[model samples]
Target: MRLFGYARVSTSQQSLDIQLKALKNAGVKPSRIFSDQASGRNADREGLNLLRLKVEHGDLILVKKLDRLGRDTADMVQLIKEFDQMGVAVKFLDDCISTEGTMGEMVVTILSAVAQAERRRILERTNEGRLEAKAKGVQFGRKRSVDRNKVFALKSQGLGATAIAKQLGIGRSTVYHVLNNP
Candidate 1:
């Protein structure tokens, strides 16, 4: 049997060093460590995908925290179930929980449900806050980078979208958007 460690950080601004260190301290080898600098909400993380592909029966998967594996409780539960069916074991270091026994299964299920509800509530609150801001006339999307007048001027000079973008240091798509809008 082999032991593999997975570590994750929410963003590039965050560091995976702490998670990696914790995994190493748990006796996971450096070569067996997989990591991702990505949001837990994203399911297609490269590191996680690689780990999933490499794991085999009788292997043990270690994560610094349950949240490192997934943010949604349902997804986490499903993943753990899959690992169990494959004869692979999963352990969360922070929670000190494993998917290897009856007690562990009960604890994992209860915690997963609670965590899932918390995540759903957090998403609801975030959406509500965003809607309130928008209702108050706050802009939500990116501002125009190139001036409309500049785009018009370039167009009047017979410059197409590509040429205008090259001249203005803006994107060709942006030039097309402005030109097509007016």
Candidate 2:
């Protein structure tokens, strides 16, 4: 049976070196290893697509971690189902779970559920914090750089939105927004 390895990082800034090394140490050859410098939530990763195209029955797929495979529980579960249907096996090294047996499948399912719940909790906490900060008079988004008083002064001087924007080096949309709001 051939061994194929998959690795992923959330962003281009994060290094894939650790995952790659782990996959290599797990007996996955360099040529059989595939990686994507993209989010685990992204399904259209190029390397993963290529790996899917190349994988066949009796081939074992190895991942450094369950999360490295994907962040979304539904997507991850669906992928495992697909692989099982294709007569392929998946092993998550970090989690020490495999799709080769019934127990492994059960454990993976439970862990995936926990991971999904954890993600939801994190999002809820973040939103609650943001709302609390907003209630405390904290502002969000980019700081408005366009001077509203300057825009009004320019408009009074007979300069149109386009002319005002050009003079202030800001977008015409900003000038129009300032005029319309104030």
Q: What TM-score fits each model?
A: 0.76, 0.90
Using TM-score, give the best candidate's number: 2
Q: RMSDs, each prediction?
A: 3.3, 1.8
Name the 10 consecutive residues with the lowest summed lDDT in model 1: 70-79
Clashing pairs in 1: none
Q: Candidate 2's error at 30, in angstroms?
A: 2.5
lDDT of 1 at 41: 70
What overall lDDT goes with each candidate model?
0.87, 0.90
> lDDT by residue for model 1 over 17-132, one digit each (tens)?
99999999989999889999887776678998888888999999999888888887667778888888888898999999998977877788787777778888988999999999
**Per-residue lDDT of model 2, residues 13-69, tens digit only:** 899999999999999999999999887676678998998898999999999988888
RMSD of 1: 3.3
Cα displacement (Å) at residue 5, model 1: 1.4
Off by over 4 Å in 2: 42-44
